[model samples]
Target: MITYSNLGKKGNLGNQLFQIASTIGIAEKNQQEYCFPFWEYSEYFEFQFKECSSVENWTSLREKAFNYYDWEVSHGNFDLNGWLQSERYFSQSINKNLFQFKSDFEIGLLDKYHYLFARKTILVTVRRGDFVNNPNYFQLSYKFYLTALLHQFNNLQEYNIIFTSDSISYCKKHFSFLPNVFFLENLKPIEQLCLGSKFDHYIVSNSTFSWWMAWLGEKKETKIIRPMKIFDGEYSKKNDESDYFPKRWIEHNENEFKLENRYWKLKVYGYFYALQSKIQYDLKRQKKIIKNKIKDIIGYK
Candidate 1:
């Protein structure tokens, strides 16, 4: 068994998710049973995650949780440690049903906002707050966001835009060119993430929070715009000795980010996707209620 008892210690939801997901991925790849500590986010999502218990006859791996090396596989109990961030560790055949909102999750109530996304929509994830003062200069440079928008979209006016951020006021003040965009209030973390996944395109910031917004999306025609490096200012493409961004995503370095090593595409047939589609359809009738309240929850600048 593989265990993640002290996974984050005190990491944010996104950070912990990345590490745990990688553990799941690794366990699946090796066909070994893996166990993690109790997940607090369980209130929002549902999955058959084994709660880690006593560990014995265990060995520890210090790969920094970046890459999946052939030598890292183990048969007995083991421990996974570090800020493991990379799709590489997820293995190509990772489980999709591993994550889904609880049956009572608020996936349906937000579809009224779907009409705002009825047209082409670009969801920009502007994650700041603590990272702004992080000594590593970990935040995405302002230049990265603007440049990604320029290269990916031909006309900003043609698409509906919305953004969710810890610093929404900062985005409103700085992204004046995007005056017509919607400013979504940060909902409960899981609900906000569920909402973030509904967009047609993305401009991801330099955080695991930003990475998962794009990763969890169900849209195939979705266009993603991401910084080449996970963090701004780091020159080594191999950060923490690993590449964080998926090889398939659109990359824009802009010499942005100082650190690296961070880290889902959901298959359409997965239980989550099928359930998600059903929920959206079922929620269609709640349009009047959602429509009346959407404006109150969303801000316009």
Candidate 2:
């Protein structure tokens, strides 16, 4: 059997999806019985698998798992607590509908947001609630958003440009000057994601919240653009070296990585082989997954 849980900060639904996606991958790859935790937003899903029992007594994997999914680990009872953020863990096949909200909730959103889907919509996801000035995180300059938007639209009048943000005031403050842009209000967090999954194109921010929206919203000729730096500090995932963001997605403001970002400590200290191994050995096997999460969200990007 395999089970997943969030051992990180509470109320982070995007990180929670990564935890869910990875566990589902490991379970399906090995054909093991799956156990996903029932946390916030559990009530929204139409669960297909049996309800997961508490994994408190289960063995935390002892075998080595090099991949993000831990699928390589010998088949045995294990509880998966890794961040497992890489798409390599679960590609298009492993339950694409895993995150769907209840039909009633979706119908309500559709009835209200029908106008958004009517036109060729460009969904701009702005995320700056907790990340505004938190030294570890970042706020994307207005320049990045405008650059991404202008890259797609020659005359902004022809297309529907919409802004959806956790902080509506921030979006208003930065993008309000633009013509014909509208803000979605009074949306619960999950509702926002459900709504975003239907938009035509996206200018995604560093937030994994928006990442999921753009990912779920993909279609033929759909444009998905993101910042070169994901999370500013330790959580950053560089676009060039990683498949953490899909190959099809375009990334803007690459200089942020080459210039302002100083998050990669391995490079900061000079990559001494001895130092790297010491840090690896110092990490406790089970809990080390959490630290690996902080570095690259627990695997090769």
Candidate 3:
């Protein structure tokens, strides 16, 4: 039997989908039964898989499982806690068979939003909350998304833009000004994912939630635009250079969008300019102090 863990985290839909997809892929490859015991939100979010008995402690189970199957199991650079990245093994066929709306309630909600999908629809997912508070996690700035939206509208004026986010307040505060931009509100996280999958095009943040939404989309012509840079700050070094994103999706380079906003340019260059001025001031002060000390020594001599 194959078993997986999320390292005891909760409420991260993207990470949870990655874990679930990876688990399903491993189980399919090895022809073994699998269980995802650590996911506490399984009741709320559902996947198409056989449910095995839940284990009490995932950490202990992970160690023992790896030890017993060391010969069969090899950890790769792409593996996240024994669960490999799904795209390595995941395909449209597997996704069609495995990931689906869990409940009749969600299905009803999907139908209610079905009319929106009748036209050329574009889904834009903006990730905030922890990502905003935590500087270490990479996030595409609002300006990057704004640039993408303008580019998309230029090419496809018919596409209706639907905005979804964990931070609805943040979305309204930032994205409300855009024409034809509709906010997805009052839906469960999984429900939101289901709704997003119905869209024809996607403008995604550097988020697994966005990744899965695009991945689960049924249209063959689905256009996915994602940020090339996945992590914020220096943490980019730790991630695999090649493995995170699918080859087919369009990658929006953050550096390309760096100069897109005059405000951002001023903020970045202004901060450095201020720092340079401070350094110069400190150096001049130190030089004057050293000069005074030398003069005092000469006078004493």
TM-score winner between 2 and 3, please give it: 2
Rank by lDDT (best first):
2, 1, 3
Single out the weakest 10-residue window by summed lDDT for candidate 2.
Answer: 254-263
Any residue pairs clashing in model 3, and if so which?
138-232
Model 2 stretches astray by more than 4 angstroms = 7-11, 47-49, 61-71, 233-241, 254-301
Give all TM-scores, in the order shown.
0.74, 0.74, 0.70
Model 1: residues with Cα > 4 Å off, grouped in runs: 8-10, 64-68, 91-94, 133-135, 176-179, 232-238, 253-301
Q: lDDT winner between 1 and 3, please give it.
A: 1
Which lDDT value does model 1 have at 269? Answer: 27
lDDT of each: 0.68, 0.69, 0.64
Candidate 1 vs 3: which has more TM-score: 1
In model 3, which regions exceed 4 Å deviation? 5-11, 38-48, 54-71, 74-86, 91-93, 153-156, 254-301
Q: What RMSD does model 2 have?
A: 11.5
RMSD of each: 16.2, 11.5, 10.5
* Each prediction's number of clashing residue pairs: 10, 0, 1
Ten-residue segment with the worst summed lDDT in candidate 3?
Answer: 62-71
